[model samples]
Target: MSHEQLKRTALNNAHRQLGARMIDFGGWDMPVTYAGTIDEHMAVRTGAGLFDVSHMGEIEVRGAQALALVQHITTNDASKLQIGQAQYAGLTTPQGTFVDDLLVHKLSDEHYFLCVNASNTDKDFQWIVDNTKEFDAEVENTSGKYTQIALQGPRALEILQPFTNVDLGAIKYYWFANGTIDGVPAIIARTGYTGEDGFELYIDPNASEQIWNGLLEAGKPVGIQPCGLAARNTLRLEAKMALYGNDIDDTTTVYEADLAWIVKLNKGDFIGRDALARQKEQGLTRKLVGFEMIERGIGRDHYPILIAGQQVSQVSSGSPAPYLKKNIGLAYLPMSHVAIGSQFQIDVRGKLTAAQVVATPFYKRSA
Candidate 1:
């Protein structure tokens, strides 16, 4: 998409004022970098970083059948999520593939809030609305009601604790609480895309700039950098977090993506339950696996992956993991090559680069 036609988040001006290099990100005009990709990336790994994630979409499901509707749509068992908690889930197609991976936050017995991919928001909202017609539920595209900010890193709690009324340390991972931040109502969740100790806050759009500036100012003592998409990508890659369009899509199943942990077949008849059950019984032919570059080359996204000199699959997500200081990526390979230490070839440009299977979640923060 062109710059003039791209969508802008509430913090667009703040990012630009900080001299962010803007780019077209899934039709949104977003910052690709500020200081630099590596510098911002290292800062997040070492200290703290703030991200404007207002472009992510939100869908609200309410009414008596909220849990029923949520369970009917998501692969994860929403019944397991407590009122104050959230769980990662996939909006699965009937064929057992993801429409989009999302977070289901239970607000009450009758209310569920979903955080969906920015690019898939409209489609996801429509899907939920269609599903709600059969249940006693009301679905709303509540994306515009809030601005989302992510405060991430080891020092995140220390930097953000002063602004929120709720105890930051008390909100365990994957849990959230409704509270006031800087005296403004906010949903403070101990969740983040980066595999770090952090929080994702949803607050009024008008209050976005104030909180954004506040977090940055407060974090200044701890070297908090205003992060951008470039660093965000690297951080997530290191942690093995899947990127929607790249790491997964409608063509890939939860099992094939190595995300079966999120699939709760016993949740009782979700959209893809039967298909997933049959697939599990039949066994998977291929699955996503992490690989490290054996040669001095980077296997970028969509590059052809070969085994025995023939194309088997393509790299789903590939990049230089800044924290690990190595070229790493994920791809679907035949089960025969899924074992660690197994080898494959990634066709980068016109060159066949050697790669080897490796353990994932390549980076994990110290507890």
Candidate 2:
């Protein structure tokens, strides 16, 4: 898509005012970095960093059969969720590939909220609607109704506590509270893509600037910085969090992606249950694994993997993990190549370099 066709979030002007370097991300004109990616990345690790995640899509499912409809479509057991709880799930096609990996928020027994990938919003919404024909559920594409801000890092709680009367401490991971943020209606969830103690605020688009500004001002004492997409990507990679388009997609099966935990086989019939069950019984051919560069070369997405002079697979997501201070990446290799210490060569820019399977989550915070 051309630059003219790129979508802009409510914080577009704010990012520009901060002199953030912009880039087209999945058809959205977004800030890639400000004050350099490494600096912003380190700030989040030691202090706090704010992110504009408004481009993510939201879908609302309500009505008497909402639970039934959600259970039928997603791979996770949505029935296990209680009000105000959220669970990571995948909307699967019957063939057992991901429609989209999403977070399902159980607002009530008859109401559920889905947070979907920005690029898959329309397709996922239509899929849900079409599948709900057998159930009495009302599915609404409410992506434009809210703006989301993620306050992430070690000092996030200290920074966000002053602006809301809602007891932020009481909200546990994967749980949310419906309250006002700076007197604006919001859903404050102790959830984040980056592996850290953080909260994501879902508020009206009109209140985005206010919340963004307030959080920054309040976080000044703790050295808060405005993070961009570049930092977000690196942070998530360090934590081994999957990026939809890169680490997974419609062609990747949940089992192959090492996301079998999200597929609840005994949760009663789901879209991909039968295929997943068959795959489980027969065993997997290829599986996702994390690897580190042993030689001085940075392997990147789609870079071919060679084992004993034969090309076996390719990289999915790779980079020099900022906090870990090492070059690492994720890839789908043959099951035989997935064991820790297994070695291979990565064809980086036509030059072969050594690599080895390593433990995932390249970075972990101190307890």
Q: What TM-score does structure 1 among the candidates reach? A: 0.99
lDDT of 1 by residue, 1-367 (tens): 5678999999999999999999989899999999998888888899999999999999999999999999999999999989999999989988899899999999999999999999999999888777658999899999999999999999999999999889988999999999999999999999999899899999999999999999999999889999999899999988999999998899999998999999998889888888999999999999988899999999999999999999999999999988899999999999999999999999999999999999988898888
Q: What's model 2's overall lDDT?
A: 0.92
Give lDDT tens digits, candidate 2, residues 92-129: 98878889999999999999999999989999999998
TM-score of each: 0.99, 0.98
lDDT of each: 0.93, 0.92
Error of 1 at 242 (Å): 0.8
Best by lDDT: 1
